[model samples]
Target chain A: MSWSKAMPANPVVAVAGATGAVGQEFMQVLHDLDFPASEIRALASARSAGKKIEFAGCGQVPAGELIVQEMTPESFKGVDIALFSCGAGISKEMREAVVAAGAVMIDNSSAFRMDEDVPLVVPEVNPDDVSWHSGVIANPNCSTIQMVVALKPLYDIAPIKRVVVSTYQAASGGGAPAMEELYSQTKDFLNGEELKVEVFQHRIAFNCIPHIDVFMDDDSTKEEWKMVVETKKIMGDESIAVAATCVRVPVLRCHAESVNVEFSGEVSVEAAREAYETAEGITVMDDCSSNTYPMPGLLAGTNDTFVGRLRKDPTVEHGLALWVVADQIRKGAALNAVQIAQLLLP
Target chain B: MSWSKAMPANPVVAVAGATGAVGQEFMQVLHDLDFPASEIRALASARSAGKKIEFAGCGQVPAGELIVQEMTPESFKGVDIALFSCGAGISKEMREAVVAAGAVMIDNSSAFRMDEDVPLVVPEVNPDDVSWHSGVIANPNCSTIQMVVALKPLYDIAPIKRVVVSTYQAASGGGAPAMEELYSQTKDFLNGEELKVEVFQHRIAFNCIPHIDVFMDDDSTKEEWKMVVETKKIMGDESIAVAATCVRVPVLRCHAESVNVEFSGEVSVEAAREAYETAEGITVMDDCSSNTYPMPGLLAGTNDTFVGRLRKDPTVEHGLALWVVADQIRKGAALNAVQIAQLLLP
Candidate 1:
């Protein structure tokens, strides 16, 4: 029963925090991508440990056979790459140890994003930054990642002077419990009963929550701050200003953005379309004629960041506006970390 | 038995789109505010001409007793003030006619919005504009009326250089049929059947559509165009820029907007909050600590525009952002029109 017909020599690739939504997607992607992994390891919290997990119908992964091991620096032994989709707290606790053990840790938490030693990577947007990873490559924020992937190529065509983005984020980014919050609250509301709130500060079923992450003294939430700083880092432009208002939409999987951009020089709507059409990991859905454009329902399950609603900002001399939608769980998180792993594969 | 003994000398008022959602709200507001209307002439089209409607248990209003008349010039001859929430075509043909009959027409339609002679008024934002109207005072687009009303006073204090708003609109804005479409589609989706969309181009059961109105030559839709033009006319600053992405959400009422504002001078988040708190018709719902803010569930049945998530745009020198929620059919269209009628008491 040895399956050794076409495996790559990367030894074994492990996905830490592998039982959650993003974690499950990581396993599916590894199999879907046919990554050259000689061995595969699925890990999660100790409680989720010993759970049976299968990959690509690769037969049964028996319970208690592969215990959900703890994420420790020692856990990185013999692993060529570790895709970390665990929270920043977990990444902080074990990332150093795992990287010290020789595995290239691609952390999907904010712990290392602003770290000068860590290179924040969006393969299509800034693959060049990958070369400088100090054994710990950082994954940008979910909202920030998709925005940069959509804005980078456009920025190259016409330098962006400022970016105004307001995100309608999906609940899946909050992990499984937040998904439960939306589901349970929705049923309660439809039944004409008062919805109980816990996972969120307010009822999230039929409403939009303006707060994401902890609020700063300045009133901006941490999620909003990410778009501000991450854009400057990923685009390698300190002069280009960015502002964001992130909202938690009742949607379950995709993150959508309405973006207004001001460029340093004149850039027509057609030119902006040309810029995105040629960029990798980006798709232009700018068919305002049929009202055909990027939207959450369409972006779900896809890997590409959808960009649309391209038009000249009639208010400014060199400005254009667009609507961006992307699968936050995919390109915004798990898929991106996996792609970074692919870049490291032999 | 003459009930005239109890009636004040208040003039008679008529509601042209009675029986519609906004019309019902108008009736509620009249009762709540104890508006000094000696009598209420509940008016509607021929089909609903014989239906009995109730409001605050004021007594049943028989549609047939409503005169079962068309909204003709002559129908308005006795109306001291006509508050209209009818369709655009109906309002267009009757607006001037109503005025000719010595009644002030407050129309909730795009039919007269861009007309230079018709003043687009959001009473709280600019009651003075009411004086400029010959007789037909226009209600700005539902989305525009709320945003500008929330931003107008702030714009005066800081002078908005640019505004980028992404609206999460409700189905009722498209009228009752759209609301039915949302409900029916949800049931169909639950039954595992493919949902058929009639009111919208795509399935909107649990989805958000970025399209609103037909697209124009410049790629902007009629909905977006109205917001841009109406904001200027209502704000009396044609030079003030606005870009909007109007979306139809699954909700039943209250349109929410994520607004990013870049002003001429530095606008602190604190100053913005104070500005909204002082602005007429604007209710500041900011309290990110508890996540208490503008939400449709809380905003439904309300007349005032709710503002929250007020924060400084950290990316720009002079920027402030917000999340604004208001009952689109009410503040966005109906109540605002009613408020204008209150401005001119004979």
Candidate 2:
């Protein structure tokens, strides 16, 4: 029943939905991280089968092509680690098959994220949570993953009391099709052509959409709900209060957040800056005078979470605000999942 | 000294910086509102002199064209209301001249906004503040103007203790040149050509720049500072605390705000919606199921402040959160100034 028993030196990594955006990132991250994988399988829906995914391999991993195969229960028969980003429903349906095949599911979907038994892991924030996983480790939501990664070091300096985050998320968070939609619509906007709004509810090119995901009964979008709940679970601090407003912008790849964190004790801007500087997987780009701050356009393909705009929120007693950005597909989903798999290595 | 004494059936109006974006909006708004102007003078820098500005007349105001004149102190000699959108320095230099010419200067520049002697007005929020003006009434910052208009209605329901606002501001808030830069840069971005970041400090096409204006010693941008100070001044409440993160998006005209307001007393979402519904110069657009929310793409050129995404913020004792959008050039600048001019009329 434990994940530890199935750990392997050269794990058989299977990427479900390999033809999709986050799925492709899973392959790229595995190659970039030089993860020790004896075999890598690219599994997708029947429609995408026979497609080829290029792996720009690193270290011992050979640079080669992975032909997409149909995803079925038999796909996980020999896999040690199964990375799932197909969808929540697919993840739920395939959970038992992957577990029955003795493979740990590092899910990018929201299916098992809130499950008490399945540990939601952000490697930098809570790698130890991976140790308790019963064959499944959930990757935190993209926005929550980046925010928590930036806040972890600060939280260590002084316990976080509350967090107010407003996200400037990119179209990539909606998947490759959404990114393409943004591109086509923007071109249409420039060409004096009528825009198509199939993927998104409204025109997203040259505009900001405040609604992301379905609206909950309380009026907060489900994306906002994920940030609130996932942060508490991942940080293992239920007492910490979180309020989020998730808005989708026209950027292609990275997600940027304006976070206001109020601490239990006074944490100076100097101390917070130092903590971020020393934190793993965080690049501090906060020199105000030089105009050195993270923009999504610049941080599109970057793995590290860029932190900037560090200042005091004068409204609260011990409040510090920061701006955080990261490539949503990489560190927010695929890379974090790979890191969790790394944590499970024997 | 009362503005009541200068009330005329047909007053002479002069628009300083008439060649600029906001100044053009000044003419459009004046015509649209059909202000009883006996004469309309288009005044700009000497380089723009002799250019013709056509007025699409409204109601009783006849359609005609005015020849752009070189802005000089003498230009305001016979003017009753001088609308100024010239830069801060010009506003400061021309303040005395406009007043000496026996005219009320409804200044759009930040030069006199924070001055204790000058009234910073949003008309809907602080129209009476204009009464104490010594021949000059300052327009609030664009981002601040929309936010205060949305908050004023909610604030009347219960005193606001603190406000956390994150703005998705358009390029027009930066002026006409900034909007042009967005257009050109977006075209460049689409064409795979080098993007020119001249008007703004960074590439604003398909990107969100956290740095709006020059950064201060505390690392907050000048635009953020304006929102804080101007909100306090316009609301006429020094006790209310405000924290703002102003980001420039790729949108052309309207500025949107995600506001989290904490009140001293209980305020339900229904009550807040009702407050915005009954409030003047405000429109509520909060039907989540129908996906009817005010977005900048649909709100450009609108005069009324749009409020939507109404929900209760559970983080505080009595907190409510909402989304606000308004045409940055119209209600945020020219329309607000014209409204102030309307207040001066009998």
Candidate 3:
């Protein structure tokens, strides 16, 4: 069931849900990567139809204001690639129309992530999974994206048996309104006003919310569950066990994870550092003497996954611990999707 | 080798470092617990001498302002109990003097925590450990105190083989100045002014700092090491393994931990919840249907250690995961030390 389509040297790109946070990031990443898009279109809901989104164009696409058009089934008529940051339902609803028009969709939603027909990809971990996608590719959750990027290089050293991770997730993972809520609530809290907590279950201004997304029957949030199942799917290994606790902190964009990994065989701290140093899309920022490690606030808008605080966990026979941080909207969303698009280029 | 002091029903209590955050909390908790004190003395550095702190009435002590006195070797004379929240150096320097004066020192510093003769205790977990302390009873680190309280009831179900905990610590753990720094820095960050990061290694406003305390030779922070070693000491099981990642979050007071525990035998979520419901000094706040759990911002000033988000981890044969939160100043430090002081009363 291998599927492949010949992508043009410079494809026509459509940025769906162009008014949202990750949607804007998709445009920025395309320009940052100098993606060769012959034409770029901005598509959104009817409410934002006439809005103008400025694009620092890429390749043949001229730098100008892109008029937001109301997205319809026909929006992808000649679009070679559609980058979607729309909600899951919208992504699913437009899936058929997107595929019918012969456009490849790199979706940033959780709609088709676990589907057998769609490839859940982190280019660093499993680029070849793209070869088997029917017409769509799914990006992993923001928290999962950064973690597996850090884990892949180490997994090459030894098969990872288990991972116990606790995340210091940022507000941006909840999208634009969530970020705005954090901003306004923080100002209100400091001003001695009642905090308006609408985007999240609790006041996310200076608090940590252990719940993310929706709760499952098992009481694990869908965000935590996504990390567990998506990692196995992307890593293409059903044997690797992942236990994740996703918590939302007041950080604006970047997410940090304290990950404890157990491997089937011993992997020393020195060996793990050497492996990460040679691995692609990873920067080692670990230096205890200098008091250096990745801080989420300082790492917003970064492309590479930063790994630090590498140490051996003496509790387990073959355990290693590390701190991972990456910009949730960039490497965790838009940048990752665009990277997958580059892989599709002929 | 064992020592016990006969404490009078109404003994004089001296609060060392009375002007600091935990020291002030010690005063509040003494009043909250209705501690019996014939007279209360406020002791601090010479700079703070003559300053007055207001205290509510506690038992035989009347409601009034206590004049601050410069602490010296003679300060402990005729003092039956000395609750110390001073820095480690001062605690170490004054230890022998306080002990020689026949005053039992309940130290809130890390000075003698790991010492062979000092009992590092969380009153809820190891009250009996107080009997072996020759003079000073060490209060466990704020992060460790809350965790051991949550772990104790679970440990009663089955022997915990190992624990992996990640902390979302508040600013208050660093003392009153640190809390003030957070306040000012957060205001600066929101107002677009440059942040002054004097108390912490980095700007902690809307950010998470993975490095807490000093970095050890193993690249693990000393705060992380404290949790590892202190948990084993308080739990009285040298075989139990613990790995901790201590991060300072933006929250002002309470500390929250995402703890993953593996036991020698299976411990179901139902049984864990039941144990927590009946456990002393514990509150069960988990109810996913209502989006209920312990949040640090709302849990400040609360006395009990809260356990929530209880779920079984399918990663290990006998594993359970839970989130624990407690006010760092209350259960973690002041209240625990005050409880230990109560144990000495005849």
Candidate 4:
């Protein structure tokens, strides 16, 4: 069936792993965007199956509640669109069942992202890639998603030669438990009590940990590996060289990145600023004299990618350096997934 | 009088601006390093003159209490060494007095760092640069000091062609008031009160601000400009290109840097690690598999410059990326001054 053809007036949506941090955001985003769905189902593991989540609906959608159900192969029987935020292992196990049930699965996990048939889509950067997906569409990593969104406009002006990114990632990227860990550990530190390290490998209260995810044989963290590969896939440019240093900071929500981009041709700062001002889903917050730049603390819970500190890089022949920030759960994962679901609507 | 001449067993020392943050650290460093001084005088602004500071002296020095004196030209009457951390204006006004009094002024302010006659010294990286000092020696910027110390060993292996650095600086780099502001603002944030941002341009309790120092004409902050020029002067290499993004995080002490270095010749990870391990003031804490990396929280109050997360940068032909952390108060400022004072002894 062609997604472009009108099949139903309103689609039936299923939110897998609905109790998760990103899963909860998925529900909020769908409501905020006023997605026309006749029915919405919240599915999770058996542990959270009976938990109730209230949705303060927006516009025409009436306020309602959902009782989470234990997901099974038969759960997607009449679902037209499924948004999955479970771990990669669960996504791998449940993807085939969702596809067989005739639902277009937009997976936030990395299980099928690198698969030859799967299309990794960032709506603002590569929306066209969504059209070629066979059964599943994948979301890029949170860090890569924001960087690509900010870089897309500039890359369109002049082809990018290479990128060097250093990330100041927040705790929310690891999920709700990680945010709780940061809060508790900080409280303990303030009270002169011993800090317990459970979610992260080290004490993250006022410290910067260079390790994120697990380490690869070559010493690069898996998070850094995802940025290098996912950036190439989402930007649809295999030849663009990328180097990443992903650091975890003691922040709660928004993830910040210092991105240095080198172009094959000359791209002036004025041209770059104009390109960002006209780009979709981007907010330019630069003005060094007035000290108006993006910080994770101020921009948390916002949907737009905030870009600031734009300047010329004197090291390269033609280069520009910028700071980018966005709420990792919203624009990076949930909103992008919902945008893809809106595209698949009849 | 030559500093090399052993005319006296103990030299008269003076601590300028002895009540501020770096000034307090100056006293601690002098005591901890056991600088042999016949007498110690604490000097500060007129408001802080009467305060008493206790020093827990080390080695041959005996513990004693010093009464802070209102600083004047006569404060350096018989002082063989003066550690100045007052602002640039004070340093500029007092330099002639200290020099005429036959005292070498180790100035910590930015007043004389770029002056051609004054040698900008990081003892481990450029000890030879100290030989030609004309009565005044300048300390490099805190952020620049740590990066160069970490890069010095690797640069010696093969000269670094270009450096791209992004810093996670601590609040202590701003001064004692900034540190107090961070603590008070954080307490207010946790208690659901309004955050008062006075010391920094933005809220730095749980955020990162890219603007440090003043903005230059080309939109780069003076802190970033300092890193570029100071790295060249400290390393004695004008051909090396540098780009930096100096950010202030909520950390209380040590500064962390994510540095990517490109070299002119081939350098392997093992070779780079060996150079750091063999360097005078560097500690290699890189064992990614076991999560043994240097973090600012764990390494505060230490003199060594910690280096970790060492790996190859696949974006450059001959390159390496590493993380460096150093106590901004100790090695970054006070300790470097004390080390230079030791070099002046007979």
Chain A TM-score for predicted structure 2: 0.98
- Tens-digit per-residue lDDT, A103-180, candidate 2: 999999999999999999998999888888888889989999999999999889899988888999999989999999
- Tens-digit lDDT string for candidate 4 (B168-258): 9999998999989988887788778999989999899788888889999999999999999999999999998998998988789999999
For candidate 4, please provide the TM-score of chain A on its own: 0.97
From the highest TM-score down, the ranking of the candidates is 3, 2, 4, 1
Q: How do the residues B14-82 of candidate 3 rate in per-residue lDDT, one tens digit apiece? A: 999999999999999999999998989999999999998999979799999999999999999999999
True contacts kept of 3: 0.86
TM-score of chain B of 1: 0.91
Model 3 achieves a DockQ score of: 0.90
Which portions of model 4 miss their true places by more than 4 Å?
A1-9, A58-61, B1-9, B58-60
Model 1: per-residue Cα lDDT over A1-346, one tens digit each: 1111222455467789988888888877776666676666777787887787666722132222344665556677777778888888998888777766667778888898998888888998888887777678898999998888888877877899988888888888898788888877877776678888888777787677777889888888899888888889988888878888888877778988888888888887777777777788898877755668877865688989998887888777788888888998889888898888787754
| Cα error, candidate 3, residue A201 (Å) | 0.8
Top model number, DockQ: 3
What is candidate 4's lDDT per residue for A1-346, written digit by digit as tens? 2234232557788899899999999989988898888888899999998899998664345788888999999999988889999999999999889988878889999898888889999889898887887778998889999999998999898898889999999999889999999888877888789999999999988888998888998999989999999988988899888899999998888899999999999899999999988899999999866789999988877899999999999899999999999999998889989988877765
What pairs collide in candidate 3? none
> Can you write out model 1's per-residue Cα lDDT over B156-268, one digit (the tens) per residue?
77788888888888888887778788777866755578888899878776677888988888888889898888888888887788888888777778899988888989777
Q: Residue B44 CA error for candidate 2 (Å)?
A: 0.3
Instruction: Specify the poorest-scoring 10-residue window by lDDT in model 4 chain A.
Output: A1-10
- Which ten residues in a row are the worst by lDDT in model 4 chain B? B1-10
Q: What is candidate 3's lDDT per residue for A54-92, written digit by digit as tens?
A: 999899988999999999999999999999999999999
Candidate order (lDDT): 3, 2, 4, 1
lDDT of model 1 at position A197: 89
lDDT per residue as tens, model 2, B139-201: 889999999999998889899899998899999988999999999999998899998888988
